[model samples]
Target: MRWRSTLVAAAVGAAALLAPVLVAPTASAHGWVTNPPSRQDHCSTGAVSFDCGGLQYEPQSVEAPKGSMQCSGGGGFTVLDDESLPWPRTQIDNSVTMRWQLKAQHATSTWEYFVDGVLHRTFDDHGAKPDAVVEHTVDNLPAGDHTILARWNVADTVNAFYACVDVTVGEGGGTTEPPVDPTDPPVEPGDCDVAAWDPAAVYVLGDRATVGGHTYEARWWTRGENPTTTGEWGAWRDLGAC
Candidate 1:
């Protein structure tokens, strides 16, 4: 009876030791920029319909050691470093609001924003956990085509999440279609031999619609999203003036 009691006690002790290991949480996926979509955001959202490899599925997994200058964070997603790829550059004013979507609300040290390889703006978190969604307003961005590299530095870990947004700031950068003049008569439906975009109508990939005297093709399925309001990486791709 004494031996049986000893065996039972030993088994319970072992189970206690293994409990924490069995229930240990795995590392969660991190974060990425969405609005004025980052390269990975473009890949994951089907805004860029190219072969972005595994990055297309795991946009929030571009984690690497701190202090990387490359857009991929010197990680495995090298497709983001390709300059020749037709990355859509979002048109914006000199001041823009950047938005980030987080999968794992990490305790952050600092949020750094860089433009054209120069540090532009930064937000200090003081080693605090961030919310699922973060927004920062960056001002006085250089007026031209530029790449904005955003870094999310983790407070507890040596790793950081990276995102790169290509943008055409202010005027005279990329060949964007000129804005429709306010004095021009409002274009009627069927004016361009294409149906005017209807917010109530569902649009899928390859669907064409006319709006604001210009034609647009849907890059992916969308509804209730106006074509003119959607930026370069949005669901609609501008097909120029009618």
Candidate 2:
């Protein structure tokens, strides 16, 4: 596996907030950042509170009435503007998976996602409701430094924007396993090379392949190639030919 080591911010708020706040740094981020667990504003200068995974963010951003944090009792969050937060820019392997949850107030109408300052994907809530969670996954993303920008119609509503990201970087391209392995017994050509084939091209959820005590099912594409087994399902795709 091609391990891409992430350069995490020495401090969480180093890249986004205007000033620095000190907090504990020994624990690993649990998974998801929760917002206002009790609907209270804990952002005070020099004090820290935010959410990630299961633990609240340490050294959280201080609440500012002029910036993104709007209501004191409602909720407040910071946009990920740092380039080092693993934004998955160009040259990134498509096999890598990334996800983030979005929360906004009533004013947001359209949410547009941008990569490297260019518009990539847009979602229209149509004023359906507030605090909607919109998730996206892209596959086989080209390698390079890319920036994903999520811009909402904040000018039209009285809502505050909040987001938390989860990124999984994988090592496969078209092949499932390492193309060459020196430790295994040599098998002759024409041997069933199951890992050599792209799963996205064939297996699909409800579709099954039984071999060697393992039953593989075709789940939706999470990232990289098709026919993956990620539990995080994606928007349904039309199998018909274009």
Candidate 3:
């Protein structure tokens, strides 16, 4: 089997915009927090993660109790909510960007973000289906130890997907990376999967496939489009070094 890029999946890029959820995610749906690698990611890949119950096998599908928003998805996945266990934290500063890998896009209600239990920002996308790729930013965060909770609430269904990113907000805002303006020149590839860039293949948000021996991740839905083409709405992201 050919290996695809992982960055577009988990532990890849960072996009921040989630909020309090009124419902839980459905069982059929799939997705995960790719950037800054969620707890499930660390367990699934044997990386710098701690205490992730059975989430290693299914990082994208952490089911919470119906109609309830929870950080620790119900069942064995409760390891995500284990406060005593050290979940690897991402180093970040004010005004952060986050990337999400949503395998099954639904009619979304709204995406939200919480900084240390306080609502900071929200991205309203109700009645609209998201692209193959999704991203957002949380601006003006207080610099300190913060638990960032990002939630994607589905509109039609009583469900939501949850991703918790632990971060240390720093003092220098400029040091933090700016959100991806797909229109701006593509930023240099960080630690991404290696593969060739394919323009003819159809892709969805968070989908990963290898081309030319290098892996390129889809930023959104596209066909017959090159990943290297720079634009705010560009469709592909290069994952460095196979």
TM-score of each: 0.61, 0.31, 0.57
Give the clash total for candidate 3.
30
Supply the TM-score for candidate 2. Answer: 0.31
After aligning candidate 2 to the native by TM-score, how far in Å is the CA of 10 from where it should be? 54
In candidate 1, which residue ranges exceed 4 Å CA deviation? 1-26, 172-242
Per-residue error at 220 for model 1, in Å?
Answer: 36
- Across residues 33-75, which tens digit of lDDT does each residue of candidate 3 receive? 7776676677778875454556667777764533334565443
Predictions: Cα RMSD each = 13.7, 20.9, 20.1
Which residue pairs clash in candidate 1? none
Error of 3 at 60 (Å): 0.9
lDDT of each: 0.82, 0.32, 0.64
Count of clashing residue pairs in every prediction: 0, 28, 30
The true-versus-predicted C-alpha distance at residue 14 of model 1, in Å, is 18
Q: Give the number of the best model, judged by TM-score.
A: 1
**TM-score-best of 2 and 3:** 3
